[model samples]
Target: MEGTSFLKEPVGGKSVVGKIVDNITNAIINGELKPGDKIPTEGELSEAMGVGRNSVREAIKILEAYGVVHIKRAEGTFVSQEYDSKMLYPILYGIILQKDSTNQIVDLRKVIDVGILHLAVAKLAAQEMPAHRLSRIEEALERLKVEILSPEPQVKNVHDADVAFHMAIVDLTGNTMLQGICNYVDKITRRSRMMAMDQIISEGAVEKFLEMHQKLADLLKTCDSSQISQIVEEHYQYWANVKE
Candidate 1:
């Protein structure tokens, strides 16, 4: 940890604790602190960064919440071993707080989903995909079918199934980063999906929604890139229509 004194004094506007968090996060991102490395003690950080111990402690807590670091009771705080889905919370929270219109959010989701489908279809078309690999998508679609067609389909159940179906398609792309980004976007749009589902149920069009999802599943199996974009557009069109 030699020569690691890169944190600067707090600047204007931002709180000292927030600045401390930023500095520590920057250190991690800059490769100064690798995973599993213990961070400087609060006393050391406070003195070096010209911040109070309380600020250092608060910064550590923020980092922990973001999955950027982990605290070992009685031991020092260390960088997280694996930055997993927990890291998506901050980004998801940001999206949730944004003032984007419902239609705009739906449009963004549509674009991401369509792009993911294109990549997945391309991959399937270029290679002989294993049946096992595609099984999850089929399973998800089956769950969705069951949920939507149930005698009394609950909105929450339908929404979860719907997310699983689309997430299955994202998984087919075999791109971790894409999957993560899609997961965040998909999570934030759950409310919109619920709203759309409610509208469909009220309109007595749940059967139509079921048919569209079933068709999308069928189209995915074909790996026909030429037709996927159009079908994907139609699938999302339902949401746009509902929004309008």
Candidate 2:
């Protein structure tokens, strides 16, 4: 565990893995290593951080589990920007072990969602959805259907599709800043939802959420702002029930 600390100042008996995880997480969050950027190699990281290669490897393993970085054989490791939102495995476990609840994340989502919903509805276009954009929604909806129908749904993938569905909605606005903000929230919200729903929530919970996302996608395709508002209102009622 030599030099395994965040600052390499020789910390206490806490898990070296945890410290390394924090350091790498901070790097990504602070934009020191932006998405699509390549991170230093395992050997380089070990030397730079003054930690053992094993310790650096273990840290990267934790990050890899969170979808924070992608490892390529013979190529190298690259930062994954679309992580957790794209996949939630070890992250789901880590959050759950902390005794956090999905409802809490849902609450946060409610705040961000309300604003996004309003903007999306107001920006709907009758025929302006580019093929690529429409394709995103369609794929997301298709994935949603599969999740809802499958008894043992792949919740993470379904959730990914859910984000994709909403991303298409925000993309409709053609606002780069708005889209980026929406994506940031999506990443943040996902960590919580996967922890709560995928790990600690009900068995068929994903199916229900998949159903909700499907309905939203269907409404989005209609390209009607008024309908979007109505659809979201009805959809939110389910969220209310979920709490009780």
Candidate 3:
């Protein structure tokens, strides 16, 4: 209301709180509001948008809960300045609630993973990966290999190892936003991923499963992204099959 006019009157058809959330979100996205910028106080927003202070309060609470904004006791509410993994919870839970989201989750994971790999490759080209970092990834991979190849593997152990192995690769990329996205997508697809790994081992395809993990590890070492698509696709085959 003072100088920033992005907060306008809420239109009809949606809940007042929802519209307020939308207006504020759009403002942040369009650069009318920026990170660390304090949004208008509740009284100002209420007066400017012709909405009740209660509605503005509710909307701000929701946004804060989602990590879209942070409130300081005396300072006022400001756009979050850094990546918050909580921002992804809505998407994660939305996918979880969908009737048939396994395919979508699998595809999402593949795309994120492939992108992460490419980022890792580019990082590798620019600077030598720390020996300790590569060792940690290989350690996770080794754990997966051992768990999957055991005479009688525990599903939980294998699943945890599988997740750790891939997450290690994601962490290697050193991008917080990608890490947050990958972490949530992993959560959304957890059940299906575990089931897929279980079936792969049961069907004597453990070798292929292990090989895919090996190839993923090798890709970081080679700094080659040409085959990333194929490798990631193959990595998700079991999960895709289970979802089908």
Candidate 4:
């Protein structure tokens, strides 16, 4: 924290809290600060930046909420060292706020889902995967099938099962970055996704919906990467039709 004279730079343009957030984030981006580095105390930042303590406190709160920084009860704040899903909230909100983002969200999801499916298929074809991992993928598919075929399937149950089924395939890739990004897109579109599931079920298309997931699960064993896009397009058809 001693060499952070950059924090003392005069603020201009944005609101006081926004400037503080940007300065600290810029410091991190430029390698002036690093993960796990302790941020200067609120009093120290206020004095350096000529801002009120309240502004610094608000900035710190925002940073902590976004998973950019971690605050200990008495040990002060430090840059986050590990992945936190909260870090994706800003992008999620930005995507949500955009006009006509449903198709965009559907497109975004289709791209990742297709990529993940291709990667998983390639990985499965290339490796002698552990029995447990293979079982997990099958188990997820079975759970979805069960929920969809239930005597009186609950919309929430079917929706969660559907998400879990794709996530299981995503997990097969063993790529943390892919998993993170996939989960972020999944979260941003959850409300629309749930509504889509309700529509599918209400239309008595439960078998058709379950069949699509079954085909996706089957593709893991049979379909080559070259054949992923079409299946993914069919998979996301309902999602794409959902209104924003």
Candidate 5:
């Protein structure tokens, strides 16, 4: 905090409290403040930020609410230990508020799926995982197979199974942040995916899609990154080509 200096007065129509929040956030981002490191006291922040104490307090409150910081009763405020799922709410909310298109959602899902596949493959290859670690993925794939083979398969059932398959891969990545983001995207795009499933089922492509998912599941067990990449590409590309 030694190099950190007083913040400039609020400008450009930004609220005073908003300016304080930005200053504290910038300090954290710039490594002037680090996780678990207590921030300046309200009086010190108010003086350094050139804002009223109430303004500084309000800024801290906002940060705490966003899970950006935490307040200790007897101790001072500190940056959050690590950003958790709560931090994703604001960005997810913004995306929903902007009314992103279905195509955009599909694109986002494709990106997340690709990243998850890559990381999962790498982790599986590099680490010594338990034999049963990927049981969830196998179980999900089995459920998908059953759903697709059912005489009267519901589109909703297939979609849920499909999501479960990909989510299992995301969970394999061992990165909590990426898992949280993918979870958020998956939840929001559930309806859009159901629509896509309807189209795929209508086109008589449900079996083909299920085959691709099975291939992905098989390749994951091999821990062959190249094969996994090929299967993942084929899986996502098939959906990309599906007419919306």
Candidate 6:
């Protein structure tokens, strides 16, 4: 594939406007451009794209209208949430912007994730998922338990474990949209999480967080989607308590 930031053309029919919109959008969609990362200044993008600053500005305006980015007064520009299929754009914007805690996000995650996993499970067979998935989920859960219990947990591990847990679910769903949204949220909010959580991870707390993981595995093992939602919510509530 072409670099994530570059658009693919039919080898000869590429247009300049098409390429600029295509490349910038590709960068954002492919994680080359990220949520908190500022877009290149108008002057910079003009130079880089070999287009006039007016063209760059127009493209940015179009992207803003698409709900793909937001421009702050002095903080420059940032990416928005990956487009949502379930929630309206305004609602998703509120949830992302007004959230004061990763715990709050965890709360939203639990509620929204419940619906997603329900749809995902519908895509799978009743017999069971695969053994590899059970192992991946369990391993991801184990890593999370370690992060929660370790006296001096690194933030990187927690981020990886967290991503692993959710990505594992994306795997279960086998849906690109599910994975895309997960990646989208991760990109958009990851910086705030990194900053806010740096001091909180090792703030002297320990507990059996893995029980929920065990419960989820149990539900999956028996092909029971009924309890999976509760298990997911129960697991995330621990993090939600960080604000309490």
lDDT string for model 6 (114-184, tens) is 87667656655553555466577777778888885677677777776767777787778666666766665
The Cα local distance difference test for each model comes to: 0.78, 0.62, 0.86, 0.84, 0.77, 0.64
Worst 10 residues of 1 by lDDT: 4-13
Candidate 5 residue 214 Cα shift, in angstroms, is: 1.0
Q: Once model 2 is optimally superposed onto the true structure by TM-score, how far is the C-alpha of residue 20 displaced, in angstroms? A: 1.4
Q: How do the residues 1-244 of candidate 3 rate in per-residue lDDT, one tens digit apiece?
A: 5557676645457988999998998899989899999999999998888889999999999999999999999999999998899998887888777877888778778888888899888877788556468888889988988898899998889998988988899888888888888877877677887888779878999888888889999988888899999999988888898954
Clashes of each: 0, 0, 0, 0, 0, 0
Tens-digit lDDT track of model 2 for 193-214? 4444454225555555556666
Comparing 4 with 6 on TM-score, the higher-scoring candidate is: 4
TM-score, cand. 4 vs. native: 0.87
Ordered from best to worst lDDT, the candidate numbers read 3, 4, 1, 5, 6, 2
> Candidate 3 local accuracy as lDDT?
0.86
Query: What are the runs in model 4 whose C-alpha is more than 4 Å off?
Result: 1-5, 128-132
Candidate 1, which segments miss by more than 4 Å at Cα?
Answer: 9-11, 126-129, 150-153, 174-187, 204-207, 241-244
Superposed Cα deviation of residue 139, candidate 2 (Å): 15
**Shift of residue 59 alpha carbon in model 6, Å:** 5.5
Candidate 2 vs candidate 4: which has greater TM-score?
A: 4
Local lDDT at 88 for model 3:
87
Collision pairs in model 3: none
By TM-score rank, best first, the candidates go 3, 4, 5, 1, 6, 2
Stretches of candidate 5 off by over 4 Å are: 1-3, 6-13, 97-101, 227-230, 237-244
Highest-scoring model, TM-score: 3
Structural similarity to truth (TM-score) of each candidate: 0.82, 0.48, 0.93, 0.87, 0.83, 0.52
lDDT of 2: 0.62
Give per-residue lDDT, candidate 6, residue 78: 77
Q: Is candidate 1 or candidate 5 better by lDDT?
A: 1
